[model samples]
Target: MKLIKWLRNILNYRKFNCRRRALFSLKCCLVCKKPTKRGCNCLNGSIDKGTASLGPCLAIIAVLLILIVSFQYIIQIHPHLVRETSLSTAINVTGVFLWLFVSVLFNHQSCVWISPGYAPKCTDGYSSKYQNVPDEYFKYDPELKNDETVRYCKQCQTEKPWRAHHCRVCNRCILRMDHHCPWIWNCVGFRNQRYFYMFLFYLWVGTFFFIYFGYNRLFELYKVSSCILTFLPTIFCKLEENKIVVMNDNSLSWFNGRRYNDENQWFMFCYYACCGVNAVMLTFLMWNSFLLVNNQTTLESFQNLNAEMRKTRKNKKLRHFKYLYDLGSAQLNIQQVFGSKYYLALLPICYAPIGNGLLFPLRDQVHQIVFADTTNEPPNTKHLKVVTV
Candidate 1:
């Protein structure tokens, strides 16, 4: 009987040991207590280190290649094609390319590093953070108590402000989050939303400039080899004032320099790539332009669509769902994203948007819809009084 009891205890100990070992092998982070990715022990609270992925690296490489190749192409080829090697032309072309390149770089960097403002901890209550905000912004159905005036994020344990949403990827609640872009490897939110749009604008312009300037040389293979500089061993090649000569097929003659044909294929490839990229970017830019003019974020647009669909299904009378933040005027909406100095909105400088991400001035209709007593009947848009608290 003693031996059987001892054997049972030994078996239980082994089973417990096996379970502990299995859990340990999972390699959950000591800080966040979440399983690490491929044995990466992340001490930081967040699960993802955005830059570890391939998307951003490829994006950075693409930008660098475009800049380097465009610089060389314009300097070595454009002046010769125009038959004007003037110092002024060289300086002007270089200056324009540099400005575009710098702007794109700045925007890209800003998008990657800038935090998309996080929601503050709501340990006390809503009043602590939103003390100055107008009461209408927090109004909800009092009788139902279903739609709480303020939203609480369970993951971050913070009060979500008016436009705030919890980003599962970042493991924090973001204020006015537009979206998470893998190419930028960051969330586009209140702080870096301006940079996100500016990056698209600059990249579109850059690709356009590339395609426009390089169109003439696209089909002519001989001109491509001579006119376009390539990444190849050029120690044996002869260099004329406006051309490079490399021996191919035993053709040592300087004029017969189609040897770099294979290498120049990238030039043509880049040309068409830019053409396609420019077209897509134009479409994207235009979409963002429409969003900007209407005071909408990408996430908000989707949410609005969902809300509209739900409203349509429930009550046809409430078919039209107006975005509460839109201040009605297009200029005012535009000013919300870019600062009041509307003229400077075109520039790539990192200007702050009008208000903090927390609170926005509500439209009169918004006040009417919000502050009015909750009822089952459809909202009366016309006669409701706009009250301030």
Candidate 2:
């Protein structure tokens, strides 16, 4: 009886030991639990580190090739195109190509460091650390009793840059962020704002050219169709000086002191088709042009402004000429928007002296003042305040 009792106890102990071992093995991490990996706590290194997939590269290359081919064909067919009407077109094509190239380069070279999933710690203008506030406002730092320099990120467990916001999708901080651009595969921040603007400018130009050319072609087609319907069987005949003359599709002839030619008919058909196509294309171009002049992207413009305002209790300001120029001067005109020192360098042409063009200093000055006032405040603070009116 004593031996049997002992044996039963032994069996129970062995089973317990085996269960404990299994539990311990399960808890073991597959990968190293480093702060760098954000406690991935993974055991196997199967998780990707930072490189972008080859698929994006391949897709970009394919798109670029297609654009190049299409551009080549268009240029070949329209070799007689003048720069005046096609200036926008030239800019747009060049801009798109540049964007594509930059996107590819950024995707390949940009780092993919992770940032906090929440905001960073900061002192208010009064030097009070808004600790215990929501993470959206500021992160908390246990060590930062009165030290303004000490900061903490709940998720990142690291210090964030001043004016940095954590991007969940990119899993990192963006500096002086304007926005993220999937087309460029990069953030349109202080560093990349120039490229973004340039891209928009070029796109607008290209769209304009395409519309002009297409409109002309459409008109030409319409004329040819009308002529064929109204003047059939005598399609190659023309009246001159009360005399009818018949001519082939390529030659001129005179009959009864009247002259007619195939060249005239051909010219009419070409002109009509060109005009018709251009008119149709012009409509689409005009819409895009409106968006550019307003300085709003298609996505930004489509957002439900009322809903956004209701949720945030803020009134969104439109990017208009007044907000784009410098306004400290006595001049009170709109030209400041374009002729301000900031934009002067960016203008393609310089026929007029700085601050002396149409709206000149006034436009630029107003925009600058508006931009300064707006920029001084927090991005969501002034803009989010709803007006009763």
Candidate 3:
């Protein structure tokens, strides 16, 4: 009976529905199994599953659609536009569009492929460095009770340092976690945070490029369709019936039997798509820019907001709370995620933060500041240690 029960436990399967079909799974990474406890690369692969889930498959489809539409526009429509416009203007717009497209693709790949820095394993809730250290070593740390500087994650079975958070989707503690992005199908955290930001920036700009160039074409299509419906109702009816009707008027000669040409219809679809995508990207880009400038993650922003609300309730006059990791300089704050070289910060290459995600440099007053007790009266500084961790 004991042997049978152990075998049943080992063979246990969970049922989940995918595309209206319920499937049972065991240790397959493509299903519900936890990521292997090995290298970061394997962890990323297991989490993303390449094209296993709907989000990743959708993302792949979107990218391919964009590529196809853009190629069609460039080949079939851009030449006429170039002839109408000056050579310099066409060259410049094409260059900018190509750059934006390339940047978006590279950054998107980086965000999807990179691991969001996992918290290293620890022995008995303490890192290797602190495993044998005396209890008095952590006495000066003010973050937690009993002067413990590290937090243990039961899910990962590891010690998490400052800013680390456990992701339910990834099922592991990600160091400096921002949030899990469904579009990328990965966590935006310390390692891939910069890539994620660049991806948003490039995608936003690329959509804007499409919106700008396609605006005139979209307007022409709309005007001709409206004119056909208004002045030539018979022709419009023919178009609705899928019959080709050629307009005899010199001004309306551009209109064929179809309400709009196939290329024009595609351009219109892409234009509206860009408009919607741009709106979403704008909101995300602006929010992320604010977080980057202030040295906070999405999680930290919510945490700080809650802290402020609690403080406001305690003291009606206190409205603003200082974040511990701001570093006080916007340039320095931006440098924390991207590399120190300011010139290369805008580039969409591998310029991730150089530090192990386990530790972070604290603000000068982190030791002196207390979230619960924020009276104007300065706390005693003699015994406080300003440790960079």
**Candidate with maximal TM-score:** 3
Assess candidate 1 and give its TM-score to the true structure: 0.66
Question: Can you give the TM-score per candidate against the true fold?
Answer: 0.66, 0.33, 0.68
**Evaluated with lDDT, which candidate comes out highest?**
3
RMSD of each: 13.1, 20.7, 10.8
lDDT of each: 0.61, 0.35, 0.63
Please report the TM-score between candidate 3 and the true structure.
0.68
Model 3 bad stretches (over 4 Å) = 1-14, 17-52, 123-150, 224-260, 308-320, 367-389
User: How well does candidate 2 match the true structure in TM-score terms?
Assistant: 0.33
**Which pairs in model 1 have colliding backbones?**
none
Q: 72-183, model 1: which lDDT tens digit per residue?
A: 4664356544554577776776678778878888888778777777766663444454455543433332111234445667887755666777776556778788877767
- Ten consecutive residues with minimal summed lDDT in candidate 2? 43-52
Better of 2 and 3 by lDDT: 3
**10 residues in a row with least lDDT, candidate 3:** 16-25
Model 3 lDDT vs. the true structure? Answer: 0.63
lDDT of 3 by residue, 1-389 (tens): 42353334334312222222211222333543574344333444344432234455555776786697677558644664687698788788788777787788888878877898876555455567644433332222223323234455777775566688888666678889999877776788989999888888878888887877865555444544333466533224222212335657666656553434666566666766787889899999999999999888998787566754335322232224446567667877887788578567466667657555654555555534432344533333322233222
Where model 2 places Cα greater than 4 Å from the true spot, the runs are: 1-55, 58-70, 80-155, 159-163, 217-340, 344-389
Candidate 1 regions off by >4 Å? 1-52, 55-59, 75-87, 123-149, 220-259, 306-319, 373-389
